[model samples]
Target chain A: MANARVIVITSGKGGVGKTTTTANIGMALAALDQRVALVDADIGLRNLDLALGLENRIVYDIVDVVEGRAEVRKALIKDKRNQNLAFLPAAQTRDKSAVSPEQMIKVLDDIKAEGYNFILIDCPAGIEQGFKNATAGADEAIVVTNPEMSSVRDADRIIGLLESQDLRGAKLIVNRIRMKMVEQGEMLGVEDVQEILGTGVLLLGVVPDDETIITSTNSGEPASMSDTSRAGQAYRNIARRLLGEDVPFLQLAEEKQGGIFAKIKKLFGG
Target chain B: MLADLIERIFGKPEKTGSVAKDRLRVVLASDRSKIPPEVMDKIRIELIQVLSKYLELDDTALNVSMERDEDSIALVVNTPVHRVREVKVS
Candidate 1:
């Protein structure tokens, strides 16, 4: 509530790691002893609960609280990993239009008063009404995107809309980037994506497609706990960086293959 | 990075269908630039609105499009003037 940063985790297109980033980043921030609340603003096509592995624990949702059926504090679902981490689940039965931008603003304001260092919103995809409502209270946003064309394009559209709302410092979080695809010219690299979007936005982080993220999503634990997963470390580093700590960029995936001799050595060692 | 490593070891593109890749390229360019298709309509409407205010012009005969390069957006306006000399050139 003191000096919290309200950030919306959004993507112009669906399936672009918005929810995963929200879950992991919220968990990472909480793990760092920062009070964090992740709001599920996806409404109808909500997956934040499932991604955070709290789908089963959701008895009351944001819609219930907004509709006065439940209190805002009562709808808050505490995470298993960190008690400081709380989640506001979206209504599965209700559509995005069921809640207005004003309701979302009120809920966020209430949570801010509860003493959170960072409030993350897992926003739904597309530049539709859902996107508009989710970003209403967002002080800033992290546009989650992949290096792929559609993701980048959608990210650009979202960036434009965010700018229209007068939200400054909207950062980019490049997710599931395959560095090999960039090397061989099959996919656009970081520079290409950045150039196309133009400058002035900070690169919050680049997340690799580490299998542990998928596994963690499946098991209901965030990928931040996976020591072997490159993405887990990346999310933790992002959390530290968000806290104003100077963490160096990590290699999510090797850009080059191992030397033939090393490959042969690995084969022998195996 | 894994894709490139696999391609290097395999020594070829992963699959066929560069056309599918082209579709991605085109769509991204259009969508990411935040250039809506509705802008073309607005251009036509504005042109007709302005032209009608001055000389009588056929609205259906005009063509509005964008000439895009690696940089800059150029709004192209093409219209046939029946009497060029009679019309006031702006």
Candidate 2:
């Protein structure tokens, strides 16, 4: 517990895959034998529970833990698939004003006392009271962004705010990247995004835009648990990197072109 | 198929990626400095007024802008000074 890490996953723009990143990375870290807790800090608009397919198991939410209505252990829902993974859902009935930044830190401290190796908070979109609450207890931060113009600009804003809070060295995760578009010079590449975001933020991982992610999310199973999903593999690599393992970035463009032969072989059941 | 073939042979006319990067560079420089265009104009006018008392400055050719590097953002001001005014002894 002394070395436990509390990280907040956030994006200034909505629908940039902040919740998905938190769910996949949490599951992947659990798969790597680390005790992980996924906390949904999006109070009014909760989705982390649904993403992890544990929505039905939520008897109490984070608000309950903060208000002393329920203990931290009572509010946490253990993932059915992974014993080491647990989730704390946000209260849907309440809004962002329901919890303050100080209360958020108290809740996280209680969760930390449970002996989790990693606590990942899924921060709500925007830079409001919700964002402050999500980041109040975090020692580190991860900024998720798409390669599009608007997303990149919002990410730059979030990075500035994080530095102002003394949360330096926040990692960057460029998600939903279309390699084909990047190859055609239609979409921004990883290097372009890094240059725009400046040198303060480090690259954590790059997740390709994969269709399997849609199917996996629909069924409450994150793509990170799938053996064939490229996005899933990327999430796994991110987990390894978090554990201090040196792993190479995935060669997404080459694999996409060379996968023709592999596709043909799969059709023949080879 | 034909379009793909043509693109492969001649390449795209313009890369939107570079355009987006260029636009973001200008936008973020202003966004991080929290200075809008009107504020920049005000700062320029104030600089010209203060400097004109001590020296003759070419206000029309004066320029004020923000330059961003890897770790810091700088307010870069470029002004043309014609001559310095001598102060009378009181």
The candidate that achieves the highest lDDT relative to the unseen native structure? 2
- Error in Å for residue A221 of model 1: 0.6
**TM-score between candidate 2 and the true structure:** 0.81
- Tens digits of per-residue lDDT, candidate 1, B1-90, equal 998898889897643223334555566566554557787688789888887666656678988876777645576788876643355557
Worst 10 residues of 2 chain A by lDDT: A253-262
Between which residue pairs do clashes occur in model 2? none
Show how many residue pairs clash in every candidate, following the order shown.
5, 0
- For model 2, what is the alpha-carbon lDDT of residue A102? 95
* Tens-digit lDDT string for candidate 1 (A182-269): 6566666666667667774788888887788888999988899777778999999999999899887775355424455568888899
Top DockQ prediction, candidate number: 2
- Regions of candidate 2 where Cα sits further than 4 Å from its true position: A253-270, B1-12, B35-90
Candidate 2: tens digits of C-alpha lDDT, residues B14-43? 889888888898888878787778989999
- TM-scores, one per candidate: 0.78, 0.81
